[model samples]
Target: MPRRVGRVFRPGSLADVKGRPTRNTVAGALLLLLFGSACAAHKGPTSNPRAERELASDLTRVFGAPVMSQGLWGVEVKSLDSGRVLFEHNARTLVMPASNMKILTLATAAETLGWNFCFTTTLETGAAVEGGVLKGDLIVRGTGDPTINSRNERAAAVFDEWASALKAAGITRIDGAIVGDDNAFDDQGLGAGWSWDYLQYGYAAPVGALEVNENVARLTVRPGATEGDPAVLELAPGSGLQAVNHAYTGAAKSAVTIDFERRVDQPILIVTGSLAIDAQPATRDVAVVNPTIYFAQSLKDALIARGIDVTGGAVDADDRGDLPAPDARRVLAQSQSPALREIATVLMKVSQNLYAETLLKAAGAAQGGLGTTEGGRVATRALLSSWGIPQSTYVQYDGSGLSRYDYVTADLIVTILARMFGDPRHKDAFVATLPVAGKDGTIASRMKKTRAEGNAIAKTGSIANVRSLSGYVHTRDGETLAFSILANSFTIPAATVNWIADLAVETLANFTRR
Candidate 1:
């Protein structure tokens, strides 16, 4: 394997789950005025190293990789008040971004769809209720709501509510198949450049307009009663995926290894591994072969559990455009997703890849009359371009940064962050969606006792060899600084990369311009 370190450097720098840690407090502003007075009174022609070497030195201390190594680091920071670049390192060099790609996907969606937009899932029947019986197919239509399995796991209960709604409308039975409409999005379950190994996991689940349980099924495995026996396996929600378990019970002190896999678009899951006899039961979440069909079947079962008779098996519908238009179908029940602002809030606070991807496709479908990854990318670039962000600055292959082909620069990230902060309509709600340091989201447990605690708000990204953190940091000097630090192809562990990134952010939090 070839190893190379490509990073550009100049002087200057580098650089919440709706928890408004920065929103409720402005006393720091008053303190800033006083601090300004103090600086003016005693400070004289202060030539701070911040202009030349501080950022470079700080970053170098954290990353000790050699020039010929595989490590690539990029740092960019700017003053929110003035869009001046303070530090630049490989600022224009493109590199893979992990989940940091969500920043662009989300920021673009916020601009294209407005902050208040929401997704709708509706249930309708072609025939009217005729005394206890739905005369025709019970149709469920979705516009890519990713919350069905996440944030709230009561989506099936919501389906129960839909069944009850039908019962209240004098329908005792559904005479036809329960149809799932996922045509809002093109049937590209996985993103470009995603690994097959990851595709079988929940985080890389099927991305359809309609999804149930995040399009994943949970499998629980427990050791057998004695050594050398077959382990016990169970599946959740009664998904029809047949499991071929090759797992065996091993010695009590032996390591427990469980592997879950299935062929592309296949319904049979192969489990190969072993569990220690004395090992505790473990659960694994794996992606479903077909999300649209899984959703239809799930709703079918939920309705049946609620006493609604669904005579035929659940059928999945690929596109709503092929069916009768909304005005033409007789609507029976409807479910609306939480407001876009709330969804975005959870999306960032949780670093939700599914939500981000669905929102990307949804934006494309709404704007260009087609819901696909390509359309979403076009819509995102068009919206950001209209806002003065040139598409040439970054190469985006997927909404989520799981794609190794996706490349972006830290400088562009900081540039966008600064623009978002200056956006009068979106600054508050948009900033409220990021993870807060030592408070909420992914960074809740980090930087608790430091100056960055409750003050640093940022997005985190991770992959095997890459880790990234980008966002705003409220400085002790009362100025909000935007920063992006991206490290790719490192030989170090993810924790080490994250710790280095945290050190960088803490440095920014304590930065004082002389």
Candidate 2:
């Protein structure tokens, strides 16, 4: 008979080290206490009779922790290799998905729009260009491309390219206004159910058919030389916005407090607060009031800087009454964004809300008739229905989970994962977009030094009291598992809930059926 090698302790038991402890004995106990879960990660086959029983009990204990008892949880884990349910808890219940909603939006977009899809923005004009001069407006028509941004001077770089294209086409001067035609997408910039308070931040930047620098204006605030001195401020891609600074420099080592107020449909950005004289320079990116005019004004500046003279001012197509018919206009220059697969990678890895919203509208225009939020929802619903997912199981208000109205079930999330896993065309591309544990994207710093590190890939969601994790992981025995963990209405700190979810994923990553 084999001898018992190690002792086991029940919860809160110290019998294993009851006697006077030796130096090695105390060290070993400390190691065990610190890495108890890491040790259990090397356990036997997760599906074996004994292992499965322990996994169930372990997972139950984890979700049943005192802090989690008051919260609602919807969890589901399954083996993709054998199509077996590994574990589940309230899997069918609806819960806030937060950024997890991007999974569904991106998956639908990948299938409906195809991986090679790209957005095209064109510079068109209806009038004649004679003697190096255009007789009418230079219209910039946008097709919901979110790539034309001013981050790191990228907008100027892209605009320089456009200027070159224009000069190459024999367009040295424009006689009319620089107009932005953003009719491809509806005029509603903000998403449904988005908080009004979040409007002032860059993350909540408005969505539009014509996006410039992600529809945000970057501001650099420098402290004045002395206390009570006015703070210095500068805006990037400076156009269509007016900054009113009421901020001052504070005493050395003082707290830095900066606040801004820019109401919707307004161009005046009121800056108020104080920055410590010794504080490092501060930077803030605020949402622009109108993306169309922003793009138009930016293009106009780029054109003038490139020696292409424009006599008229910048304006939106809707604001102008006399616009040429679509058929009568001719394309002068155009810019095509990167492929959808690359765009999806950025969207999933960073959980970019603007990209999510734009992709939804783009899919709507591609499959349905119009490029609108509701159209995207209808298209997504149609796709989900084809996969046998009932509409009652999930409610999608916006492509990005920014909408407080969005809700989904753990079952729905896993079902989408399983479907994507089974599709040969999209399997590799879709999975490549998720954030790997301790590797990259939003979860880069999470699950480090654990079995899940470099082994699990998932999307994380967080908004107020809601936290979610859902994606794929390969077990120790090489069996692939898809899981979803949604926790909502938790009164505890978000880090506490995140710990619970990470522990659960780490458990799955260490699972084996050897």
Candidate 3:
């Protein structure tokens, strides 16, 4: 008989995680105390149940007491072969997935648009330059390529390519304005239910058909040479942002608390707080107001550096689904983003919000000719519906799961994982994207010294009061299992909740069939 473990231990509080405490508070703590004592007495697997009996015991022990009171968890684990369900606890309950929602978004993208799909950005002109002068605007169009960043290219190298191509096409000077056209996708910049707090950061960068450097401006801040002096500020790929620094340099040993904020309903970048004299320079990446205009201006600057000056300034065309007709002139140069599989890998491994949103809009654009979130939501549901995943399992709200409104069941996540494994065409490409426990990506520090180390591939998610992890694991008995564990409405520390979830996965990895 397995010994009953009656102890309920809670580690840390949720007060440390920025923007996470709103979901957990004193009221939540009171609720936890009320029901935790009762939940602690519950049992699992009354009879002898093979490998899962121990797993149930472990989960039962963890899900009891004060920790469980703070948050509700939905967990499900199923065997790929033999069609056996290993464990289930509130598997059908809808919970916040956070960034783990990327699993479905990435999967849908890879399936709807083959893994090899590539987004293209092209350069065209309505009128060709004669004698190094063009009378009309130089139009640059993008088809939802998320690359064009410093990671892939350096120092506007790609834009320099565009400039060279323009010169090669017999254009030494652009006498007209440079126009940026992103009509391939709709004008919807932010996701549905996205709050302004999220829209100001790079992670919540506005999505567009054309994006450069992730549509953000990096603000580097360095303390002044002496105390009581203002800190120095600089913006990279600076286009439409204006930062007002109200920060001051403190003593060499003074406490450092550098901060940046955008006041209520204002587009201004307000910098505050303090920095030490000897402290290293820090960077804050903020989302730009307009990505299309930024792209246009960036190219304009690049052309100027390449000795091609424009008589007129950059033009955005205020693309509100009203784009000018394509020019009859031939294209001068083009830039192609990496294949969809590569982008998917980054999206899952790092849980990138910008890339996920871009892919979501791309899906809608592919299916409905409009890359709006609604269009993507319709197509995403249909794509999963075709795979037999019901609409009831999830409520589609936004890409990247940043919105608090996004909800999904653990059972649905496991089902999707199982189906993806069965697909021979995308099994390798899809699974490779997940973070390997104690080895790579988001879970690099998870499940260390346990059997699950380096053997589990999963997606991790975290928000205010939410934390989740879901993916595939191979048990000691050589059975492949798909699992999803989601938690919401918790008042405890997010790390402790994550530890409980990790223990559950480790138990699955160590399970024996015999």
Please report the candidate that would top TM-score against the real structure.
2
List where candidate 2 sits over 4 angstroms from the true fold.
1-47, 150-157, 236-244, 264-268
Q: Which pairs clash (backbone N, Cα, C closer than 3 Å) in model 2?
A: 45-512, 45-513, 46-512, 149-213, 150-213
lDDT tens per residue, model 1, 340-365? 88888777877878888888898788
How many steric overlaps does candidate 1 have?
Answer: 7
TM-score of each: 0.86, 0.88, 0.87
lDDT of 2 by residue, 198-246 (tens): 7877888878899888888778898998899999998866345788999
TM-score winner, 1 or 2? 2
Model 1, which residues run further than 4 Å from truth?
1-56, 64-69, 237-240, 251-255, 264-267, 277-280, 319-327
lDDT of 2 at 397: 92
| Residue 302 Cα positional deviation in candidate 3, in Å, after optimal superposition | 2.3
Q: If ranked by lDDT, best first, what sequence of candidates would result?
A: 2, 3, 1
- Choose 1 or 3, whichever is better by lDDT: 3
The digit string of per-residue lDDT tens for model 3 on 192-263 reads: 767766666888888888788889888888999888899998876544767889998988977878778776
CA lDDT of each candidate?
Answer: 0.75, 0.83, 0.77
